[model samples]
Target: MDTDLGYWIIPLAIIGGAIRVSTPFLFVSLGEALTERSGRINLGLEGTLVFGAMSGYAVAYLTGSPWLGVLAAALCGALFGLVHGVICSLPRVNDIAIGIAMMILGMGLAFYFGKPFVQPVAPDLPAISFGWWSDIPQVRAALEVNVLFLIGAGLAVLLWWMLRATRVGLTLRVVGDSTDAARAMGLRPALIRTCATAVGGAFAGVGGAYLSLYYPGSWNEGISSGQGLMAVALVIFARWNPLACFGAALLFGGAGALGPVLQSVGVSEGYYLFFAAPYVLTLGVLIATSSPKRAMTGAPGELSITK
Candidate 1:
C-alpha cells in the first residue's frame, strides 16, 4: 500500500503476470496462425483448449507426470482439430459455424467429465529459475519463467523460420492463397487444411495444459474463461505472423494482469472492473483494425471468415 511499494511491485507483478498469462495466448494464437496460414480457420480451438486443460490435469493427476499430461493434451487437441477439419472438408460446409459447434461440444464434454477431478489436485508443470541472482523476493518471483513459455517462444522462432524457408511453408502459403494454385501444384487442399488444423489444435491443447498445469494450476469449469476464443482476434492482430503472435500475446497478458497489479498495489477502487481489461483490449483491437476482408489486415485470400 505504500506509495513507494506501488512503483516497484506494480511493474514487476505486471511483467511476471504478463509472462504467466500470455502463455495460453501465445500457444493459441500460434495455433490459429498455423490454421489460418493453411487457408482454413478452426474456431473450435476454444473447445480444444478447454478440453485439453481438463484432460491434461486428469492425466497428470492419475499418472503423477506433468509431461505425460502435456502429451495427452496435445493428442486430444490434434483429435479435435482432425474432427473439425474432416467435417469442414465436406462440400459446402461452414468453418465458422462448425467451429462454434465444436467449441460448445468440447466445453460440454469437459464440464460433464471434469466433475470428478474438480476437487482433486494435480502436479503442476515446472518453472525455470532465472531469479537466483536476485535476492529480492518479488524480483525472484517475477523472474521465475515457466518451461512452457520458453518452449512456446522457441516454437515461434522455429515456425517463423519454417514459414520463411521451408518447402512446407511454401505449400501452406500456396494453399492459403489459392486452392487453384495448390491443385495446380498437385497438392490436395483439403488434406493440407485438415493436417494444418490438427497441428493447430495440438498447439491449442498445449496452451490448455499451461492453463491447468501451471499458473491457475487447477481444474475447473471456468478455468479457460475465453482465452481460446481470444486467440482468433490475436491471430488477426498479429497479421498471421508467428513472431508477432508472441509479442501480441505478451501485450494481452500484460493487459490481463493490469487489474491484479492495481489490486496488489492496494487500489481498492473498482477493482473488479480491472479484470475486464483483456476482453476490452480484444474488442478494441478487433473493432479498430478488423475489416470485411478476411477479418483484418493480412488475411489469407482463400480465408472465408468474412464470406
Candidate 2:
C-alpha cells in the first residue's frame, strides 16, 4: 500500500509545489515583462524583491495584517523602481551598470534593516482551498492555493488585454520600439519608462511579499535565491508577453518543485541537487533564446540586451 501511494504522492506533491512555488515567479516575471515592454531592464529586481520581503514582513508583524504587508511591499518596490529609473535616465548612464548597483544596494539594505525581525513572528497570507470537495489528503493539499496566485493569474490575462487593446499600451509600445520616433511625436520616453519601471518594481515587490509572507512564510536573506535575476531570462523566454509570462513562470516553478517532490517519495539521496533545477532551466532558456535561428520577433527594440 505504501509503495502504491508513492506514485500518487510524487505527481501530486510536484503539482502542489508548482502551484505554491510559481506565485513568486508569476509576479516577478510579469513585472519584468512590463519593464522590458517599456524598454527598460531592472536587473536589480532581486534587491527589490528581497527588500520588499523584509519591508512586507516587518509591516505585517507590526500591523497584524498580512494584506497591509503586501501593500507596503508594493509601495517600497515602486520607490526602488523610481530610483532606478531616475538614475538610468541620466545622459551616458548605462542601464546594466545602474541595475547591478541597485541590486547590491537593495540586498544590503534588506540584510541590514531586516536583522531586527529575524526572530519575530509575522502574519502570513491566506490560502483558498479548491480541493475542499476532496476527501483525500494529497488531493486537498495539492488543490489548496494562495489568494496571490489567483490574483497573479487574473492579472496576467488583464495585462495581456491591456497590452493589446489599451491606448497606453500603444504608447508604451511606440516608445519601446523606437524612442527616436516617440521623440518625433512629442512623447517623453524618459517619463514613460520611469513610470513603467516603477510599476514593474511594484509587481516584483509583491513577488517578494509572497516569498516572505506565504509559502516559506518567513523573513530571511536567503528567501529570494536569485529568482529576481532569473526573471529577466523568463521575460525573454516569454517574448515579453504578459500571458506567456504566466506559463513560463509555472514551468520554472515546476522545476523548482522537483527536488522536494522527489525527496518526499523516498528519493532523498542527492535530491538536494534537484533544488538547482530552476537555475539550470533558466540557463537552458537563455541558450534557447539566444540561438541565431530564432528571430527574436517580440523583443523591445530599445532594449540594450536585444540590441
Candidate 3:
C-alpha cells in the first residue's frame, strides 16, 4: 500500500465532505430548530426525509425539473408535518409515539411510490463553479462545490438573524420556552407549533430532494442511511442555533466521508467501522450534551421529549 503525504488532499477532502454531507443535516437541523423553537419535537422527520426523497425524485422525473421536484417534496413534507402536528395536539396523544408511527408510515409510503422510480433518470440540481482561480487539476476538482452548500450557509445566517432580530423569532422562542407564557402573552401556541412543524417538514423534504436529485440520483429502498435521525441529534448538539447546526453538520459530514476517503486510499479493512463514524459521533454528542436533570433546561420547556 502506498501511503503518500498528499497534504492538499486532506483539505480538499474536508471541503468536499462539508459540501456533500451538510445538505441533509442543514435541512433537517434547521427544520428541527424551528419546531423545537415552537415547543414541539417531530421525531417523524426521519420518515419525512425519506418520503421527500421519493416524492422529489418521482416529481422531478415526471416534470423534468429538479426544482419542481423539490417543491413537491416540500409540500408533501408539510402535509406530513401537518398530520403529525395535528395529531400530537390531541388531548391524549403522545408526540414521540406519534412521530414514530409517522416515520414508519412515511417510509412505507416512500417505498410504495418509489418502486417505479428505482431506475429512472431524474433531473439533478445545478452546481456552482468556483474553480476559476485554480489552475491545478486537484484544486479545480476541490473547488467544484454544490449550490446547496451555499444555500445552507445563507439559511443559517438568515435563521440566526430572524431568531434574534425578528418578532416572529421572538414569538417562537417564547412558545418553546413556555407555552403557557405564550398564551399569557396572547399568542396561540398550537398555531405557532403547527406552522413551525410545517416549515420544518418542508426543509426536511428539500433535504431529501437533494439526496435523490443531486448527490445520488434515482430512487431505491436504500438511498438514505439514517441521515434524518442523525439530523435530529444534530439539532440538540447545535443547541437550536441554525448557525451552530451548520458547523455541527459539517463535522458529521466529515465523519461520514471517512469511509469513502479511506476506501479511496485503498484502505478497506475497516470500511464498515468507518461507515459507522457519523452515528457514533452523533451518539457521543448526545451523551455529552444530554442530561436528565438539565433536560428541560436546554430544550424548550414545553417540548414533550424534554418533559
Which residue pairs in candidate 3 have backbone atoms (N, alpha carbon, C) closer than 3 angstroms, thus clashing?
none
Off by over 4 Å in 3: 1-7, 266-268, 283-297
Which residue runs does candidate 2 get wrong by more than 4 Å?
A: 1-4, 268-273, 282-294
Winning model by TM-score? 2
As for TM-score, the candidate ahead, 1 or 2, is: 2
Screening candidate 1 with a backbone cut-off below 3 angstroms (N, C-alpha, C), the clashing residue pairs are: none
lDDT measured at residue 291 in model 2 versus the true structure, 0 to 100: 60
Root-mean-square deviation (CA) per prediction: 2.4, 2.0, 2.6
Please give, for residues 76-179, the per-residue lDDT of candidate 2 as tens digits. Answer: 99999999999988998988898899999999999999999999999899998999897787788788899999999999999999889998988888888899
lDDT of 1 at 262: 86
Task: Give the poorly placed runs of model 1, Cα more than 4 Å off.
Answer: 1-4, 279-296
lDDT of 3 by residue, 1-307 (tens): 2334465466677677777777988998999888988888889999999999999999999999888998999999999999998887778788789888988999999999899999879989888778778666655655666777788789989999999999999999999899778999999888888889989998999889989988866678998888888898889888888898999988988777788877776777979998888778878877776767644345678877667
Let me know the TM-score candidate 1 reaches against the reference structure: 0.93
> Candidate 1 lDDT, tens digit per residue, 200-281?
9999999999999997999999898799998887898888999999999998898887887787668869977888877777
Per-residue lDDT value at 267 in model 1: 88
Residue 296, candidate 2: how far off, in angstroms? 1.1
